[model samples]
Target: MIKTSIQSSASEIKSAREDFFYEQPGSLPGTLSIEEDAPPPVIVLIDYNETHATRKQVSTPEECIPYLDSKSVSWVDVQGLGNEDILQRLGNVFKLHPLLLEDVVNVPQRPKVEDHENQLVIIARMVIPKEHKIGFYSEQVGFVLGKNYLLTVQEEPEHDCFETVRQRIRQNKGTLRKQQADYLLYTLLDSIIDGFFPVLEDYGEVIEDLEEEVVSKPTRKTLEKIYRVRRDLLTLRRAIWPQRDAINSLIRDGSTQISESVRIYLRDCYDHAVQVLDMVETYRELAAGLMDVYLSAVSNRMNEIMKLLTVISSIFIPLTFIAGVYGMNFNTERSPWNMPELNWYWGYPLCLMAMGAIAALLVVFFWRRGWFENYSTIADDTNNKNYGSKINLLWRRSRR
Candidate 1:
């Protein structure tokens, strides 16, 4: 199931990349454009009042008509968008405006709130953290609030953060049982807003882990991860930023379906949206900083490599010069002064001794100058021992 869900999510994202699901140019208003790959609609009805509550899966939209007229609060959750006929029937049953139905069917619309006389339509985006992954599954959720009923349409059947709300309704926990449909809307919106915190926590953890990896030893893959993180944060920001305005509109605008008390609760939900936006923006800045850190790390590594190569080359230059001079083909017989040392009994040994002495002196000079401390630091770090005493003592002696 996990694999299938992941695959479907990947497909959804691919479609989003191609283009958002939109109506064709010159198309009539309220024209519905359903994706060919959308899953069939599944409607669930939950009717509850202070005294009694009932939950059941309704096969057809008409089954929900009777409950909408009751004094109790009815929540009709319609998941998936595969069947247009069913969605149309559902809209007709609820007496939804044609344009309102269009917005509900359209997947991936910007988050916004529109007051349609007695009905309050809220377009929202919900995100669920991907299982065993660093990203989240995002989908659009549309809410149509009436006098005694709230209709919610979602893009898919799975990967929603509304399960907690469902559990609350089922257990009759909190004041959800007593509240009207507007209050129920507030509760669900609050749940959706609160859901962002956990996903943001995951991102925070990822940023922490990347900080360590980027500083220690960054790689091409690290760069890719950083870019991915930035992209995802941007996606999150896009999702939550508009939501703030939408929630604000809900609070600021007048609506008969939304009561004064529910509007007050929505103020809290608006605050949560602001918090999510803050976290997203902060994460985006951190991700951008990570990119800079990755570049600096790569450059530092390159410089270290070059420094090591330069040190090796500097040591070999003198040796190469001595060897080249000795390798000359000058004849000792022709001139004693030219090659007198070539005939000495210990000439070969003396020459090797001289070369070794010169090399040792160069090494001491470079060491006292503290040029190789970085290498020592690496060694000491790995062994977890103070291996720099000798170098420090030598440095002090040379300074004296």
Candidate 2:
């Protein structure tokens, strides 16, 4: 799971590097699509009963239609919705509504849930970390829950967190083999909910790293990443908040399709969803506070830079004017007022000493005033490995 999260974060950072901007909102649903290079769908299935179980990759959605009506549980897993033709046909074979198919094909249709008469459709966002980066790539997952079968749509063939569920069913490791479709739905939802843990853990690590960076080495990009994390967390918050309410409504409002036994499982799923939402909200608050700190740190840095420049100019200006005055070669022999200071044997050394003394005095004054120490005291290093390098980086980058 940790390896998977690392890969997800790397992928998202790379994708984000491309500078993909958003279009106008509320245009239409299922509007966004995959490029021509997208891989074809890979369909896998699991059919099981208390007595027996089977798992295989089926070639077409029609192949599963017969099993859908059977007494045993059927799970048709479609990973990749790039082939819109196959997706539309799959919708037909399963008697899916147009909007539901649209939602499934739309790639990222906002992690959501919708009711479609006899079918219960759920949209979830799952994160898989990239191989070597610091953020996670979010993928949309759509599930169509029916009376005897469950159909799920995944966006990529390269990623999924269903291995545990598959192992449980194959080994009959749990009561899953004897359960109904709704229980299967819970199992999948539980996996998706659990998947957020690693992603959230990644963010927690990020926030810790950021707290140090912001206070010690605040950069424009650091501010950018903070805002990005806040924005993505908001995306997450918006996604999970509704699903919690949706699940709560299911548990409280009562739905016939959800059995009493499955309702209990859904309640557990709801709890996990609520937990995810809570963590996201907390992270959002922390990120916002970090932004404020970043702004103040940057402002403080600017003031420090200006103060250094001011000190240099203030000490040098008067000294330069005094030197300019005596350097004039007017002969004191012709007039005593002409160059009396220059006639003094110790004049040059005295002026030099005075300038040096003034500079040293200003330094001591600033040091005593506690102005330099205040800004320098804030240490912002995250990820305990970088003890001093990051601090030095901040020092070089600091203005004053």
Candidate 3:
């Protein structure tokens, strides 16, 4: 186990060194690590005013330099972190802090908030819904907000929640155009936070369904599903909990770049994060309870089956032994003294009557104990006010 642990840790270190790196603490703040596999940069420039908005996909990050100093609130979006040199040039173009560049290039530093002179670099985690499952595609989002512009660098050129923000800016749909770069950052963060609701809601419904399944007809699959849900909730909790703290810290630690109004929006964002945590924790505990219920239900079922088989054997075993003894011919004709009861006129009738009475008594005993019903139909008896019928079912089925 220790060796396995060592191997896993070594693999993780190798991945880290190979994948991405942020600046060492207090080193040049905007430094970049050019990973060997880093891809060419994809830049998107979105510059907008209260009356109009324009967007463009640029091949080079340097193309965005002219608009950064403009009065319009410009959003320079860089997607993919494959090319280190281009990312560095992009950072220099925006006058991004060395540490900020490092944070962006690192792909996934923890979701955090930091101030770099005139720029506020906010690192956040975003998750896109998985197409085939309940889990999400996690991405690191680095936001560099300045007085006149906001630069966001994403890990890849894939899924993002920025479309809504883009639409709002383009259509002049809401207060987005009236606000500054900080508000735009808030919009994107809020979109990412909102995305979790759908995933969490899926888990919520699954958990509710499991509640019935565990108590009614739990199988090994039910147990496995409960465990997986718990495990995934742990993953989500780990993700959202820190993001919540990050937002709260940002609110508490004021930045000159973030307007007072935008700070209010950030507080709202923090509240949403809290709500996410609450739902995650609630689902986790509920899933745990279902697991316990499943274990108890299975054990109860086994015990019931055993009881039924025991009853059948107990009744039939003695009766069969008596019949077997009577079936034996003890040379009664040769010696009536040896088998006087056999010669009695009503001997056979009396013996048969006695056996019938014993069988009847056993039937009455099983009935009174309510141990002659099918256990497999427990789920059908969900609306039952009492469990007696289900127990009887279990016994009857076991005897069969």
Q: Which has the greatest TM-score?
A: 1
Q: Tens digit of lDDT per residue, candidate 3, span 1-400?
A: 3553455456445654533335567855455665566556688889998888899998887788788889999998888888877877887788766666777778557778888788888888787777777667777888898889988888788788778888888889979998888888889999988777767766776776787787778997987687677766766776788789888988998888888888998888888887778777877777767766776788788888898888888788768977888777687878866666767899999988888889889989888988787654445445542332332233234324
Report the error of model 1 at residue 108, Å.
Answer: 0.9
Q: List runs of model 3 lying over 4 Å from the truth.
A: 1-40, 324-353, 373-400
Task: Tell me the spans in candidate 2 whose CA falls farther than 4 Å from its real position.
Answer: 1-35, 345-374, 379-400
Candidate 2 per-residue lDDT over residues 1-400, each given as its tens digit? 3553455467457654432224347766544465576678999988999999998999878899889899999999998867877887898998987767877777555555676578888777776656576666667778888889999988888887888999999899878988899898889878877676566666776887788888878987996788678767765665577667767776786665679989888887887787777677777787777877787888888888887788778767777887787777899889888878777899889988887887788778767887455554465335644532333233223313
Candidate closer to the true structure by TM-score (higher is better), 2 or 3: 3
Provide the global lDDT of candidate 1 against the true structure: 0.81
lDDT of 3 at 180: 83
Worst 10 residues of 3 by lDDT: 386-395
lDDT of 1 by residue, 1-400 (tens): 3553455457447644743356678999988888899999889999998877888999999999889889999999999999999999988998889988998898778888988777889999888888887788888899999999999999899878888888888888989988999998988898888778778877877887787778777988987687677767767877888889999988887688888998899988887787778677777787777777777777778777888888888888998998899888589898876867777899889988988898898889888998776541222143422222322233234324
TM-score of each predicted structure versus truth: 0.87, 0.78, 0.79
Q: In what order do the candidates fall by TM-score, top score first?
A: 1, 3, 2
lDDT of 2 at 307: 75
Report the C-alpha displacement of residue 77, candidate 1, in angstroms.
0.6
